[model samples]
Target: MAREVLAGRMGLREAVRVGAYADALADRVGAARHEYERQSPESRAGEEAEARRYLAGLRSEIDAERAPSRR
Candidate 1:
């Protein structure tokens, strides 16, 4: 991507900013994976269930938003 900037594809400032954001996001994902891997099996199961519930709630909210409004 830095090379893309040199090739006149994107401005240097935008490329640097985007690269920094991607790096930060990857770091966060790596940390989360590390933490999850260190958990006990039972704890991991509980975490998975909780995540599922949270995602289901989000799906419901999105569905409600997309529904047509009643008069």
Candidate 2:
């Protein structure tokens, strides 16, 4: 469970900062997994391909969300 003692005391900006840290941790974990797969010769090519596709999809989704609507 998350320790919410400090969370109650934090302001909105601080809470967003905490969330940003959590997002960063997720990115780091993904990078670590990619690296581990990269080090294995047999699975390396397939893993790298998967990682590229995953990242491309994520980027495209983020871009779409950021884009302004035509209406």
Candidate 3:
């Protein structure tokens, strides 16, 4: 990507900066979201449920991979 930027590839540098900015923004948002969720017990429960729902599929896949029988 840096090579492409140095090779006079238009927009590559800006694109990389934009992607980096987006990643930083996402990290900030995630931190703020967790902090917001931690502010109230009820809200924390709701947020945890929402997180579990989101992660359920991935968790199932991972559990399947790590199942004791598989080991």
Candidate 4:
């Protein structure tokens, strides 16, 4: 969160707001994970790998964005 603010992706006040909502966000993530786990292996086939790749791409995008601006 602090990194986001330092990277200029989020302001301090927005970070504080996100902090306040963190618990709720965590709960939702947990619920989603639980539901995903409940799915049969056949139904979930290939999804975990796809999700991992998607998340890795997002991380790369964020890292690129956080790099010092050339301009």
Model number with the top TM-score: 1
RMSD of 3: 9.0
Q: Report the C-alpha lDDT of model 4 over 1-71, residue by residue, as the tens digit.
A: 65778999988777767855566667888999999989999778778778889999999999999999998
> Which rank order by lDDT, best down to worst?
1, 4, 3, 2
The segments of candidate 2 whose C-alpha lies over 4 angstroms from its true place after superposition are 1-40
Q: Give a tens-digit lDDT track for model 2, residues 12-45.
A: 4554468666687678899988888668676777
In lDDT terms, which candidate is top?
1
Judge candidate 2 against the unseen true structure and give its global Cα lDDT, from 0 to 1.
0.74
Instruction: Pull out the clashing pairs in model 1.
Output: none
User: 1 or 3, which is superior by lDDT?
Assistant: 1
Provide TM-scores for the models.
0.62, 0.45, 0.34, 0.41
Task: Evaluate model 3: give its TM-score.
Answer: 0.34
Candidate 2 has which clashing residue pairs, if any? Answer: none
The CA lDDT of each predicted structure is 0.85, 0.74, 0.75, 0.83
The TM-score ranking, best first, is: 1, 2, 4, 3
C-alpha RMSD values across all candidates: 7.9, 7.8, 9.0, 6.8
Instruction: Give the Cα error of residue 32 in candidate 1, in Å.
Output: 1.6
Q: What is the lDDT of residue 56 in candidate 1?
A: 100
Provide the lowest-lDDT 10-residue window in model 2: 1-10
Runs in model 4 with CA error above 4 Å?
A: 1-18, 46-71
